[model samples]
Target: MTVREDVHSAGIPVLCQSCEARHRGVCGALDPDQLVALAKTSSKHRVEPGIELIGDAETVDSYSNVLSGVVKLTKSLSDGRQQIVGLQFAPDFLGRPFKVESAINAEAATAVSLCSFPKAAIERLMKESPELEHRLLKQTLNELDEARDWMLTLGRKTAAEKVTSFLLMIARNIDPTVNPTAKSATFDLPLTRADIADFLGLTIETVSRQLTRLRMDGVIRIENNRHLTIDSLSRLERRSGA
Candidate 1:
């Protein structure tokens, strides 16, 4: 159990000083004293790509905040079919609050770093700080909106529109400060052709064909098959039907 007196007096630990998500994530809602208390029980984890952070239907013992890289949330059928439900990036929270089990599997899509806290400890903090709870609630709502938007992209958009929408989603979400009318933007793709196909509900051949079309149309430039450069945000958005 965390004693309040000890936290206010002891100050934050060395481990928290360099946390990349400190000011941008849920921790930003906490005061220094609360952070000290939270850090006392928190642990850092570095995961490799393809490692499952939480298995579907497994008991939830903890929650985490992504410090870097990407995580893919997926649902699987008993027959081994699976679908990518969502993607979590740095500064995003993981695990469901007040829930005993996970509904989906969370796998590291890239080399990932996280700060983990026991569920009990985090719940205790939430009780004491409504701000923290509000922060989490806000994140949940934003994710909900994104999920709804993605549903439309998957169900309504054409193949070319889907590819464009995917790229625009990556650009817009990867950096919140991405200029809406910038002449160009550059970023590396977190998912491969297979993963992209799975997420977009398309075949790998279709994904490849669309990507090649995007390149041929001069909307985007590709190098090394992963790094992509968009020449015009407006043009991309037009192509994306956004």
Candidate 2:
């Protein structure tokens, strides 16, 4: 039989067969036997919004794969102030490998689903699997690129552009299938206006005003203050100055 057939015949674990992580996450690097080994020790769970998944400087014992929903990463100041530093979506690996302690706080921004495994399992697997390490490195580099892009957004973009860019970023990342040419998209506003204001370095009022403007201009539709639909992604992109 062919290699593809051989891999399939090896039998993927039931828990991993349908997992996005198996198809697109770091777990994709693992073969069926390796997957079975990982799945044997992994557990799936959900976290409610506002729940802390990991705290800044906390000892790292385990790692997770984001199964669904958004995770908000933050950094805290000595004065107890916090800044939303990044966001994680489904299929994203949820920890820094090789780090003994976490440097940032990770919280469930929305209702989040996760598949967790002990840190030792992943670290051991990484030592045996170069593909696994490569996948992790690729994700880290992608995050670095995103950080640079966000720096541009925060530092140089106008307030209106920042808001539009935020929406565009969410649209693209929340669903990996979303492309620049997509006609439309829909999703909930995962972060509250106040939280979004903090993330964008704007006031809550400004966020509200921008949403109102987008809705008025037929760029998007809002319902119940949370659910939103992009009426025209191209127009939204233009508004974002991208």
Candidate 3:
């Protein structure tokens, strides 16, 4: 792996000091001096789609914050069946704190950028900063809530409902800064058809068919295979059974 070290005249990485996620991410728990110390030990890397950042059952050596793009977490069965269990977006912290090994595989779902820190550095900070610990706890609880919601969707929702629910999730969470009152939003789909199928427990053809149906119904407009515009988020939410 190639590592890039970008430092400013002040001896801190410009990327770190100017990070858009600074106030919203784990770094928000740190002070300026702490950020500098952490930045000194960190590296920013641009990773390709499909790059596995961590493997199931692998020893955890570091932590990362997604700077951009999406990451999918997956688990595999002994029989070779695999399912995408979760997705992580920008500013989301990676790795399980207090655990030395991972239970799921984390891979880039698109071209991604991340700021990574060694586990030792993060542990040291957490021990010294109660705010950091609190931040992690809050994030864990949010993930738990999402997991429960997804469970309900998977267990009881119809295929069309499941697909709309997934799209609604993307719209609501993809950009934290998006205006809540905005009637429409446009963005690229982060997952491939096959990945979406695995995540939704459907076949790839079903995923595509549902998307087409949604387009025809005027809930969304597919600009291409990857780009889409939600014509009316309200209508989409109703279709999602929300």
Candidate 4:
């Protein structure tokens, strides 16, 4: 199974990985001892929903990797409108890796779980392991890919297309890289109407209107405000042009 790689989370705590070759999840480099040391030094953290996990333009003491739930990397404009720059799921890292401070606000879109590691210790570990650096580079590439995809989603897709596209993007419970044939998946929704509007470049009214239309049309069955159940994956995929 393809696993979700961890980013350097700015919020949350760190955890241990026994019987592991890397300190974090499948970091792809590092020996067992190095992984153990990293895990030992890292601490775990939890946050309730709607909390700011990482403040805007603030330097964090360490980095983090998400264990569960969702997070939004957002930013505010001069007009006081907050835009969600990134939406992160589990096994993803959160903090600024090379930079001392993060550029956006890291908020818990849902109740979040994660692990944090001291930046100083991580920097020291990097000096000892060039292999870890390579792994970090790979992680950086993955993050860039995600960013590019979001750019397309935000810049190109239409409203109906955007909602359908969003469903397709989150359709799989497994890694997007390895699960092409894996349909019939389940995962959690990361954004509220406000968050969705900001991410989709639509207003709250537009987002709610679109969602109400979708539910009325039977494109999806909403178990509640937070949970969604897809009645027809093929239909949704067709709508998304996937």
Q: How many backbone clashes does every candidate have?
A: 0, 0, 0, 22
Q: After superposing candidate 3, which stretches have Cα over 4 Å from the reference?
A: 1-3, 7-13
Candidate with more favorable, higher lDDT: 2 or 4: 2
Q: Please give, for residues 1-242, the per-residue lDDT of candidate 2 as tens digits.
A: 10111122235766577777788999999987788788777778878899999999999999999878899999999999999999999889999999999999999998888888899999999999999999999999999999999999999998999999999888877865446467889999899999999999999999999999989988989999999998777889999977
Q: Tell how far residue 76 is off in model 3, in angstroms.
A: 1.3
Question: Which portions of model 2 show Cα errors greater than 4 Å?
Answer: 1-11, 176-181
User: What C-alpha RMSD separates each model from the true structure?
Assistant: 4.6, 5.8, 1.8, 6.3
Global lDDT of model 3 = 0.87
* Per-residue alpha-carbon lDDT of candidate 1 for residues 107-173, written as tens digits (9 for 90 to 100): 9887887888889989999999999999999999999999999999999999999989999877766
Q: Give the TM-score of candidate 3.
A: 0.93
> Would you list the C-alpha lDDT of every candidate in the order shown?
0.85, 0.88, 0.87, 0.68
Clashing pairs in 3: none
Better of 1 and 4 by TM-score: 1
Q: Sort by lDDT, best first.
A: 2, 3, 1, 4
Q: Candidates' TM-scores?
A: 0.89, 0.93, 0.93, 0.80
Question: Which sequence of candidate numbers ranks them by TM-score, best first?
Answer: 3, 2, 1, 4
Candidate closer to the true structure by TM-score (higher is better), 1 or 2: 2
